[model samples]
Structure formats: structure tokens, C-alpha cells
Target: MAERRMMLRDPGLQPERTRLAWSRTAFSLTLFGLLCFRGWCRDGNLFYGVSALISGVALTAMLAGWHQRHGKQFLSLSLWSVGALLLLNSLRQVLA
Candidate 1:
């Protein structure tokens, strides 16, 4: 009988790719936040300002503790919250 062995590391650079993807996402969120701030400055919309603040805080938290066990959970929640905020803002703009 032959015993199977588990590999300690991924051979396909999955971890590196994942890290890069996350970095890109963080960069995108930063850009989105900046755009929101710009919108607030131009139109004085409180929602834009609040969205920018939330984006900044979420990005900070995600980056600060990404290696922790609960980091993914936090990331998921942050993404959903940001998405929801954007959706609500879009709906408001359309309705107004």
C-alpha cells in the first residue's frame, strides 16, 4: 500500500496571485474613494462624503489585518457594505 503526501506549498503561485489580486482591489477601492471625495467637493453631497469615509476605513482595516484568520470575513463584509452603499447612492441619484 502507498501513502499519499500533502504538499506544504502551492506549486502554481496561487498565493502570490491572490495577494496581487487583493492589492489591485485595494488600489481600486482607493481610487473609488478619491472619486467619491471629488464628487462631494464638487456637488457638496453628503452621501459621497460618507461613502468616501467608509471606503477609507474599510481599506485601512482590510490592509491592516489581512493576514489574520478573520481577515477574509472582514473583507467580505467590507466589500458588501461598500457595494450596498454604491447601489443605494445610484438609486437615490436616479430617483432624484
Candidate 2:
């Protein structure tokens, strides 16, 4: 079977902070994606708009998952997702 990647345990620990951080990252990605897409798509259909939409979906997915779970795996998933977005941003900057 595929390895399980997310968790949803209370763990009796503070989840609010973790959840808030994830929410912040998600919001940032949504904002960045929009900004980049707008800049890249100034002309009729410059493009990158599709990527902005995808990032929005990713942000929603991360928020939904994090809000419902607070475990190591959940944290890991959020971290990886945020990291991926950062990496993509770096790539865009370098490639541009």
C-alpha cells in the first residue's frame, strides 16, 4: 500500500499555532501566485494565470488538511508544500 503521508491526531498539544502558521503560508502562496500571474499576463493572455489558479487550489487543499489535523505527518505535509512553493518562486526568479 502507499505510505500514509498525513495525520490527524490531537496529541494533546497546541495545534492553533501550527494551524495559524500553515494558514499564513497558504495565504502567502495565494497572494504571490496572483501577483506573479498578473505581472506575467499583462497582455491579452500572457499566461501564468493557470498556475495562479493551481496555486490557489493548493493553498485551499493545504488549509483544509491542516485545519482538520494536527500531527507530525500533517506538519510534514504542510512544510513540504510550503517549501515546494518557495522553491518554485526561486526558480521563477532565477529563470526570469
- Can you list the residue pairs that collide in candidate 1? none
Off by over 4 Å in 1: 1-12
Candidate 1 lDDT, 1-96, residue by residue in tens: 133345365678987898898889889989988998998899988878888888887788768865355677776776677678778988999999
* Ten-residue region with minimum lDDT total, candidate 2: 43-52
| TM-scores vs. true structure, each candidate | 0.74, 0.46
User: Relative to the unseen true structure, what is the Cα RMSD of model 1?
Assistant: 3.6
lDDT of 2 by residue, 1-96 (tens): 234534555665667776677678777877867775785578333235545555665666676774455444654565466456556766876899
